[model samples]
Target: MLPFVEYAAKGEHTASIIWLHGLGDSGEGFLPIAQELKLPDDLGVRFIFPHAPEQAVTINGGMVMRAWYDIKSLDLDNRADESGVKASAKAVEALIQAELDKGIAGERIILAGFSQGGVIALHLAPRLAFKVGGVMALSTYMCAPQKLVDEAVQPDLNIFMAHGSHDPVVSMSAGQLARDTLQHQGYQVSWQDYPMEHQVCYEELVAIREWLMATLS
Candidate 1:
C-alpha cells in the first residue's frame, strides 16, 4: 500500500476523500488543509492523504523528488510521464479499493490532487471501474486529453478545477484548455480561477470547500 496518513471522521465515517500531493511534496504537505476546511463533522467524511514515491524528475535536472510522474518538458503535450502516471493511477486505484473494503461505496469517495497529482486524478477518473463521487484538480492540467474522447461520462463524476491566473509553473492557458476539452467531452466541471501564482489561496480554499459540499454532500 502507498504510505498514507488518515484523518478519521469527526462523526461517523460515511464517506472518504483520498487526496494526493504535487511533485516533490509528500502526503504531509496538504494534511493541514483538511483541518482548515469547513467540512461539517456530521458529514462523516474521512480524509486520506497518500505520499508519492521518490523518483528522478527529468525537468528538475533528474534530481530525485516525490512526484507522481516525471516531467519531460514545459510543453503540455510531452510534459507528463505516462508510465509513471499509470503506475500512480494504479496505486490510487488501490486506495479507492481500500475504502471499498472498509464498506464505503464508490460514489461516496472522492479523488483529489494538486498539480502533478491532479493530473493523476483526472487520468484515473475515466479508468475507474466504478464512478466516484467527484474529482478536485488544483493547479494542474490534463495529460493526454485525446485518450478521454471515448471515455464514458459517469453519473456523478463531477470535476472541480482551480488554477492561478498568474501561475508561472503551469500556465493558466493549460488549465483553460483542460476546461474546454473536458466540457466538450461532456464532463461536469466547475472551473475557478484565483489571482495568485502556483499556490492555493484562502479564497480558493473557500471555493473548494463550497464545491466539495455541493458535489460530495
Candidate 2:
C-alpha cells in the first residue's frame, strides 16, 4: 500500500477523501488544507493524503523528487510521461482499494488533487472499475486526453475543476481544455477560476467545502 498521512473522521469513518499533492511535495503538504476545510464533524470524513514515489523528473534537471510522473517538457501534450503516469495511477488505485477494504463504499470515496496530483486524479477516476463519489481537480490538466473517450468506464462522473487565471505551472487554458473535454464526454463538471497564481485561495476553499458537503451528504 502507498504510504499516506491521514486525518481520522471526527465521528465514525463513514466516508473518505483521498487527496494527492503536487510535484516535489509529500502527503503532509496538504494536511493543513484538509484541516482548513473544517468540514462538519457529523459528515464523518476521513482525509487521506498519499505520498508519491520518488523519481527523477526530467524537467527538473533529472533531479529525484516525489512526483506523480516525469515532466519531459512544458508543452501540454508532452508534459506527462505515459508509463510513469500509469504506474502512479496504479499506486493510487491501491490507496482507493485500501479505503474500500475498510468498508467505505466506492460511492462514498472522493478523489482530489492539485497540479501533477490532479492529473492522476483525472486520469484514474474515469477508468476505475468502480465508481467514486466525485473528483476535485485544482490547478491541473488532463494527460492523454485523446484516449479518454475510449478508456472511460464512468461516463457520468461528478467533477469539480478549478484553476488560477494566472497560473504559470499549469496554464489556465489547459485546465479549461480539460473541463471542455470532460463536458464534451458528458461528465458533470463544475468549473471555477480565480485571479490568483498556481495555488489555492480562500474563496476556492469555501467553494470546495460546500462541494464536499453536498457530495458526501
TM-score for every candidate vs. truth? 0.96, 0.99
**For residues 68-131, could you state the per-residue lDDT of candidate 2 as single tens digits?**
9999999999999988889999999999999899999998999999999999999999999999
Task: Estimate, for each residue in 112-212, the C-alpha lDDT of model 1 and write its tens digit.
Answer: 99999899999998668799989999999988888787654553468999999999999999988888878887788999999999999999999989987
Highest lDDT against the true fold, candidate: 2
Cα lDDT for residue 210, candidate 1 = 96
Best by TM-score: 2
What 10-residue stretch in candidate 1 is worst by lDDT?
A: 148-157
Q: lDDT for each of the candidates? A: 0.89, 0.94
Off by over 4 Å in 2: none
Residue 50 local lDDT, model 1: 97
Instruction: Evaluate model 1: give its TM-score.
Output: 0.96
Worst 10 residues of 2 by lDDT: 150-159
